[model samples]
Target chain A: MRDRLSFYILRESPIHRMNPLTKLTLVFSLILLAFLGPVEWLAILLFTTVILPLSFLAHVGREFLSATARLLLPVIGFLFVMQSIFLPGGGTALVQVWVLDITLENVNIAFVNATRILTMISSFLLLLLTTHPSALMSDLARRGVPGPISYTVTSTLQILPQMQVKAATIMDAQRARGLETQGNLMKRIRALLPLVAPLVFGSLVDVEERAIAIEARAFNSPRQKTSLVEIDDRPIDRRIRWGLILVVIFLLGSRLWLK
Target chain B: MAQVTINNLTYTYPLTEEPALREISIEIQAGEFLAVIGANGAGKTTLCYTLSGFIPHFFRGELQGKILIDGLDTANSKLYEIVEKVGLAFQNPFNQISGSKFTVYEEIAFGLENLGLPRDEIRSRVEWILALTGIEDLAERSPYALSGGQQQKVALASILVMKPGVLVLDEPTSQLDPIGTREVFQVIRSLAHSGQTIILAEHKMEWIAEFADRVLVLDKGEIVRLGTPQQVLSDINLLSSGIGLSRYTRVAHRVNQQKLWPKGQRYPISLQEATEAFGRLLSQEGGSKK
Candidate 1:
């Protein structure tokens, strides 16, 4: 609610100044290239040379690195563990522990898969870090995405923080009334019902009112809508979008040739 | 001619046995500030929704009668069509937020944007309304970051920017603190003075006594009393009906019970009137003693 619920960083940079649709295209293109490029190390190469450098250009390098290490590394680590150990039917076993076997070929495939996933998520994360949700929704709506679809996405972004705040308040109030949330796992699980019931029921009541509110504002009116905050889409932004598409196609073509 | 006419209006919510409004009839003319006062479960909020065309359209309940606002029947028209003529801002300020925009300026422009107005006109209208509601400095701030009063003002400005003929406010300050209530009331007072047609339901009696042109008292979903503020607020039966009276009116009522007030003089409903009435009585008694 402060600026947005997403990872958007407010900064003045070329990436921040680009159109939201262009940044969106760039995100999908990066993801496509990471998954379909010919080289086995293509995911790692894109992460280092493309995504990391672009985060700096977007003036969010520190946030990008810290968030990646904090939020994504654990999942990737778990994936690598499972894939290297339980992965069957390939290559020589480098290590054998108890009943599990870890193989060099399996480890290599796991590393590549993990890096590809990292590249995919980071590309979308970069887009989120640079673009506001409203700007993205507005651009999509203008491009003939139905108004309700865009509205649902943007409203969900806004309401999520509010619901969390409400949940916290409910938890605090219940705790003050001698409802224990810190104890055995069973006790904590039991505490969740008291906390969640009010949050959910209270929010349900608000839904009717919010619907009436939006209707009052002519949200369902059948007409071409306008936007207040003007999003800029210069000639360069369009050219960049086309360039990203071509790169995605090239990556796909190379992947086919290799196969 | 932003007149609101409700005739024989009896409405029940969906799946409810008892009607929320019972055979209600009221006509509000253009540029009139009508204040509706009642206790909890007294049908005041229901009346506000009915006037704003949400009863038959949005709620889709069984509405026995018809409501006409600005010559358009509420039952026959779509809510989007009725909304252009009537705007409603209800009790909870947070719920009234459209939840679709980020900044206060865009929030105000949301309605105009949906209505397909030109960009320049929408900008000017939003700017003027921001200043009008005294929230020009908050234009760039996130709507969710605002205080309750500030958010309510933003809600009000969001509606007023649409230029609806009739504005219906249901306890817009109910969720605010004293200072916040005053801030919102100040904006509403200005809107009242500017000849806007307003229907307000409130529990605060002092502001109603001071600013409202006409007052309607509802009890058990029926119109019990309807008159000017002085006539309705100063009624002796108002205290017994559970709808609170202003402090000035209560004091005057006490004085009348003591047989000190003049036999035929009307009881005062506001502080200024109460002071003048007592002052006149005191001077007259002093002159007779001399």
Candidate 2:
């Protein structure tokens, strides 16, 4: 397992320096424009023109493309293939196979659907890569988000990796004692019980102590909490955020107007 | 003036019949280092929680009587308000980590940020605490990626940065190795010497004997003995109560029983005192032989 669950890659580019909220707004705008805009191939257009270029500007172009290929391509590819064969609204058949017909209309619709999903995932992946989770949570919390909600999001990002490490340790320990974790299905299933019990109970106890620990740090203090890292919401960031919002509104509104 | 005052305090945890602490009363002066020693289930942790305002505020227990910090009733004050006056660092350094912070520097600043301090103030305080706890080099390191000892020091620094008037430690080194335990004790010893009002629950009797201004021994859920470390740590009855004496005191007791030690002399609680007493005995024997 990866040592950490965060997608953030630290770099000194303009995109990395953008306000987290602005980047978040950009991601949401791209997604809405792709899925809800009144234009065919808008998803593919946004992927090539906006998201892909932004990834390079952020200096994570290589990582972004690899992540998209590794993580998103398979899911989108599967969806495209499955929907092309199974979706029932196509009229013109492009090819015939035994008892099934691959229709041209179905292929077109699946491509559109797949590109929309690809655009959505890749945009979000770009945001995660550029902005640190804590910085995002801090900016959100500063903008009047509830403290506990922000805390839950940030802490989960860190805790998941620690939990994975703990699980691995427990698995190794049980294996050393001759617990059959590798063989057939039943053996692996039985091995899971021993591995799971300690992790769950141990974590539950840690939760109690953790709750006390944070409270001691005044986590629930009824005061305006400040952040140590100052996330700069520059004038350019503000303009970008407003521009994204307007674009999203225009896209959605024009789609409604056209309909 | 007493910085902490507990009067006839009793507390039972939620869903439990037995009170974790019962009729416990004590007055601790400001800047005094008070050490608490007890066997398992003897309410050492419970007392630490009580002092830190967790027993009634966080645990939601059946609390009777009063605990006052700087004359502020803990039962009336909010947990946050109490936390401002008393900082608590417990065992299990891993669990004590806020987990929200990525770096050791940010982790220590977590408490200050919660208090709504300015960014510059938070930075200065965190930097100061990192140096004080001797984890300045580990400031940029991940809080999760540290040895148990380093994590424990980070935990202590996180609380210390708040500059709480009273520091409550509940067996802070219980989960550490000997090296880790010593590292933690060194920090605590320095804090004690700086005259921080500290109430530490610990099992390391030798360290307590050397550093604690007074020692309080608890049995079950009540205080059985409270006095200077020399008076309380050397008490023979503490053995029957299951609170073991320091090794020096135990050896002195054994030798006193054999009449090798001076009659009615107090048992030594530290290595330095033990060495002096033994040296005096050997010299007197040598003079007699000559």
Q: Count the backbone clashes (under 3 Å) in each candidate.
A: 0, 0
User: Once model 1 is optimally superposed onto the true structure by TM-score, how far is the C-alpha of residue B241 displaced, in angstroms?
Assistant: 2.6
Candidate 1 clashes between residue pairs 3 or more apart in a chain or in different chains: none
Instruction: Report how closely model 1 matches the true complex, as a DockQ value.
Output: 0.81
List the TM values for chain B, per candidate. 0.96, 0.97
| Local accuracy of candidate 1 as per-residue lDDT tens digits, A190-228 | 999999889889999999999989999999999898877
Off by over 4 Å in 2: A1-3, B257-259
Q: Candidate 2's chain A scores what TM-score? A: 0.95
Among these predictions, the greatest DockQ belongs to 1
Please name the candidate that would achieve the greatest TM-score relative to the true structure: 2
Clashing pairs in 2: none
lDDT of each residue in B168-268, candidate 2, tens digit only: 99999989999999999999988988989999999989989889999998988999999999899888889988887888988988888888888878888
Comparing to the true complex, what docking class would candidate 2 get? medium
Model 1: runs farther than 4 Å from truth? A1-4, A257-259, B283-290
Model 1 residue B281 lDDT score:
84
